[model samples]
Target: MKVMFSAFVAALVIAFAAPMVLNQFGWSVAEQTSSASVRLD
Candidate 1:
């Protein structure tokens, strides 16, 4: 049980921190996907 709990905590931390780390490198999801949208100007 203790090992499982630790693993869950580690996964949660990674899930939350990974985005911030990527954003630091300017690799945000919104910026990447926005380019694919049609600009109906």
Candidate 2:
């Protein structure tokens, strides 16, 4: 249970932090995803 909890926390941190790190490199992930979603509609 402890192992699983630690893994889950690590995943959550990565999920939230990855986008900011990528954005610092000028990767418009949110913009691209939003535009793609709009096009699908």
Candidate 3:
């Protein structure tokens, strides 16, 4: 019920907020988006 819904919201916040917070310290999380067209030759 309420607890489960709150936990889900908290998890969502952490997933997005954690990376932003960490990046402020000169760190970054790996991105795996499909729109990237990088190819190392």
- Who wins the TM-score comparison? 1
lDDT of 1 by residue, 1-41 (tens): 99999999999999999988999998986887787658697
After superposing candidate 1 on the true structure, give the runs of residues whose Cα lies further than 4 Å from its correct spot. Answer: 30-41
lDDT value, candidate 2, whole model: 0.83
Query: After best superposition, candidate 2 residue 31: deviation in angstroms?
Result: 8.9
lDDT by residue for model 3 (1-41), tens: 99999999999999999878987774654443343677889
Worst 10 residues of 1 by lDDT: 28-37
Residue 32 accuracy (lDDT) in model 2: 56
State candidate 1's TM-score: 0.64
Candidates 1 and 2 compared by TM-score, better number = 1
Which pairs of residues collide in model 3? none
Q: Tell me how many clashing residue pairs each candidate has.
A: 0, 0, 0
**Per-residue lDDT of candidate 2, residues 1-41 (tens digit):** 99999999999999999988988887886655565334434
Model 1, global lDDT? 0.90
Off by over 4 Å in 3: 29-41
Worst 10 residues of 2 by lDDT: 32-41
